[model samples]
Target: MHAKADQRIRVTLTLNGRERSGYAEPRTQLCDFLRHELGATGTHVGCEHGVCGACTVRVDGRASRSCLMLAVQAEGRRLDTVESLAGEEGLSDLQQAFRRHHALQCGFCTAGILMSCEEFLSRVADPSEALVRDMLSGHLCRCTGYTGMVQAVLEVARSRRLATGPDSQQENNDV
Candidate 1:
């Protein structure tokens, strides 16, 4: 039999610091491949049209909507999802902030929000409430009324700033 390309395409990428490969149809969304193929269910699938932000993930250090991208598009890229948020120490700083603030209700949108916040916090060590809101505009959370989320993100940012030292400019800027 002659070797020929089939409908399935092999995709290889770095997932949560680990190398992984999976085959998928060219039309398969990255969100689907992550969940069904790789078992990374932390990447939720909400609006397939990329409106709800539930499928948000970090591709190559930037926030991206997995549903909007095909699985093949993720080839050779580093992808970060909500699954990588936790460590041996337990909940990450952002997750701890969310838990302490009770920022989630149904929890459907928590993963995407956390991923977005993680990427934002990594880039912006100090963020004002306005800045946080602007950063979170893409995410849509029906639960917690958004106040708790804002508070949680602000707390994380403040704690990060405090960790830098007592003289951090972001100190006393608590939301």
Candidate 2:
């Protein structure tokens, strides 16, 4: 016998460094599960087909489009949403840069863009302006015109490189 189409499955994953479990239909999108089941509303849903990049989240340390993934597919994986970026003290460096640069206007796309940038900065310690722009091309923001975002990302890159030095390991997400 096969599972019914409406059958719900228990999906367990490490979310924001904490183990989380929720029940959802196997066909439910990861974004929906995160928002409705886990109460992680920061992961937005836009252009569910995945072109808009508004549903971006970190899956096992890489930026992934949650809208493109099924909730069941995320079981047993480590996932990080925008809520994971900040600490008890304050916002992360990347978030501070965005705020200082006025990189967000309406803020609908900010969460996903921030998640993507967090993953990018972790891998590229000293990113150039062109590369930063390239990485941001995947996201879509109706406001802020992308200039402030580019500047913010570059500033964070410079800060991370200066803090860790060129030869040192890449910046950590907590920084």
| Candidate closest to the true structure, highest lDDT | 2
Q: Which pairs, if any, clash in model 2?
A: none
Q: What TM-score would candidate 1 get against the native?
A: 0.90
List ranges where model 2 is wrong by over 4 Å.
171-175
C-alpha RMSD of each candidate structure in angstroms? 4.9, 2.4
lDDT of 1 by residue, 1-175 (tens): 2223458888899999999999888789999999999999988999899888989999987888999999988999999999899999999988988988889999998889898888888777778899999988898888788888899998988788778875655422322
| lDDT tens digits by residue: candidate 2, 1-175 | 3446799989999999999999989789999999999999998999999898999999998899999999999999999999998999899998999999999999999999999998898887778888898999999999999999999999888887888876887656533
State the local distance difference test value for candidate 1: 0.87
Model 2 whole-model lDDT (C-alpha atoms): 0.91
Candidate 1, run of 10 with poorest lDDT: 166-175
